[model samples]
Target: MEAPPLERKLAAILAADVEGYSRLMNGDEEQTLATLTSHRTIVDALIENAHGQIFGTAGDSVLAEFPSIVHAFNSAVAIQQAMWRANQELPEDRRMNFRIGINVGDVLVKNGDIFGDGVNIAARLEGLADVGGICVSRGVRDHLRDRVDATFEDLGEHSIKNIARPLRVFRVIFDPEGDPAIDLAASPVESPETSSFVEQSLSQDRDSDDEGHRVELAFWESVQEGDDPAEYLLYLERFPNGQFVELANARLESGGTGEHDPGIELAFWETVREAGNSEMLEAYLAKYPQGQFSDLANIMLGELRGS
Candidate 1:
């Protein structure tokens, strides 16, 4: 009665979505839909020609599985270039650009549909990419390194929902004229460091705390800012029983606020300048218990008590 179990295989998955689909539809629904339909037609054909299969598609997104990393990368480049050429004739406001993300991992295929952390990570990476740009997982990058004629920039590791480990990322830069220049393999990218505020706080803590604890705090701050939380999680795996392990776990649970958000930052500044109250500080501390700006939270709380 039940369907057969899906087959599992190692595949390079490419996820792509239109960057501003909603905006385009809102501006001109009829034309936008027409363009999307035409674009999909072209893309579907290209994918088939490149030895890839289109297993899924949503409103403005597509998911394809390729047997080879090189084929996946080549298909993606072809799709982007074709779309770019098509958009050239359209008005700037009428253009529909896409963002793509690729990952190579084992996935389950059922009824031609793919499912796994591999698919989820690929979609999330697509969200992180710029319009008309491509972001690929480290696995995909490494697989395609020898075959592609594109340069890749390390974007560091990132955490993705439903994935147990951080996925390192690289942005592919397509050069129409120049040959690909391979750089000697380097160490993985580290997390970004906190600004002066965190540094000053750590400096003060250093004078009073044990050297080991100071080092731990430094590492924690780096993880918070420098690298993607997903990547930082990978670090934790390596140092499973390390000091600050509990703290790291807590931050991961809380989803530390490190990524840029103008709205949240503005609200935080407003709370400090206007309320100057413990209620505000408590709220922030609760939301970001081990936040890189925890010292700032302490200072605000102190001011609230007139200390």
Candidate 2:
């Protein structure tokens, strides 16, 4: 008989770990352990209340699965808030902060345990988060975009270890009191001129006469789902002012790769300067092979790598 095929399902995974665990332990192992134990209780309760299942835990880390991505996001916010409250009265040396990351993707299920990039990405995202902060993959943000009233600041695309594609990430901004936070940076109303980007899309022929529009739509959809930087270049090459040009440029997030809006190019340079993400540097060099910042980016990348 052939072996059974492993089951797979689409779900959201939330990964979290205490920051500076080793340093905290070095200071006082007993207090650190006790505090972690106490914090887990609060985290567990909030997660359960949000309809989440805790599947894995090790030392100061937690891995949970949620059928609903929104619930995953909510529980992450709640857990962080609870942790913040727990630390308020403690001495600075005794306080503990946890970093969280959430992602929605397909995963393999076996004997009550889940495995795959879905879980892997969540774990890696945790590493990128600041202490006591939450980072979410693009998929999770998209699912919660309209349904949840919260601010998600784009951190740009990242080249995660072992992941096939560079994943786009976002940082969540939530109120500790649990009130939904509005994205103040967003304009409530859009003028017709500003909405032009939405009006133009994969229909590249400048006319979208009929058959040409359909073909472009298919390619655009593929590019969106594929998350392939090269495909984004192709999309832009075909339609410079395409509807998704900005989005495609964002996904590309580099200096030169291909022609792009001058405004977006400046933004990329500024973000590269601010974040100093090595992946961003690499992407910059790769996309904008002949970009103005190519030499500077190369120098910085070399310094980062000690090359």
Candidate 3:
């Protein structure tokens, strides 16, 4: 028998699954089912509002498609923010956090269901995401460049299970107050209040920059102690002929700073920013108590922990 011709098209797939669904269900199936039902209603409504179609679903999971990658990205952010708000009303133990992943690629459609590496990648990406977090493939990330207002932390590349090539993955930094795409019909006119705010923000940036230039801070501040040879090494690695090079070299030659393996602070910062859970902040603080961005890290830790 000859099989029917396959129907395929480009698509943006969003795959989401409840984090720790098995544990939640095992603890109380009835309650979990009840809460999931209510959540599904909210989720489906939001997806539809964003022009996304629910193509498939399994227990504690959802599969949706959006024609536009930007909208998909927006919807994913909105869903996580919505879920966070919804979870707040429930007891902490019963709250359900969903991990969402999005990807854009060619897809095969049959009987209203979608199947392809695109869908598969989305699912795998979902697994890579933190509970209540979102992950997107490089395709989606590239599409998001200017279409949406969001921040993504590059988590580097990964070799997917059963996939021949490695994939670049990025984690969307969760924003409590999610930003949705503006309506196409909305006027491009900038209102007085918005214009004022924008102007003020720019003014502040200019002022901050002036202050920053006087100090030439951040990276230099970390190595200022000049007590760690690795720190000097790091500075040298970053700036071979910097003003501090002479000092760094002199310090090194003088049987310099203790070899305390001055950590790769940039990479660590990236990991902290890509944190899937609040615990990463704690780990970061413990390791880099006096490191750069500790203040920001503390603030972020508090936000994630208290949220």
User: Considering lDDT, which of the candidate structures 1 and 2 is the better prediction for this target?
Assistant: 2
- Computed on alpha carbons, the lDDT of every model, listed in order, comes to 0.69, 0.74, 0.72
The all-Cα superposition gives candidate 1 an RMSD in Å to the true structure of 23.7
Which predicted model would earn the best lDDT?
2
How many residue pairs collide in each prediction? Answer: 6, 4, 0
Error of 1 at 34 (Å): 0.6
User: On residues 286-305, what C-alpha lDDT tens digit does candidate 3 reach at each position?
Assistant: 65686543544554565456
lDDT of 3: 0.72
> With candidate 1 superimposed using the best TM-score fit, by how many Å does residue 170's alpha carbon deviate from the native?
0.4
Least accurate 10 contiguous residues by lDDT in model 3: 179-188
Residue 293, model 3, lDDT? 38
Off by over 4 Å in 2: 1-5, 177-307
Q: Per-residue lDDT for 203 in model 2?
A: 44
TM, every model: 0.56, 0.57, 0.58
- How would you encode candidate 1's per-residue C-alpha lDDT over 1-307 as one tens digit per residue? 9987889899889999998899999999977875676567556656765778888888999999988888788878877876675666567998888899998888998876899977888899898887888999988888778787788999998887777888788999995223112110111123446445666668877555555544544565567555466856865886676554554555565565533443343344334334344554565565556443344455446544753
* Segments in model 3 whose C-alpha atoms lie over 4 Å from true places: 1-5, 179-307
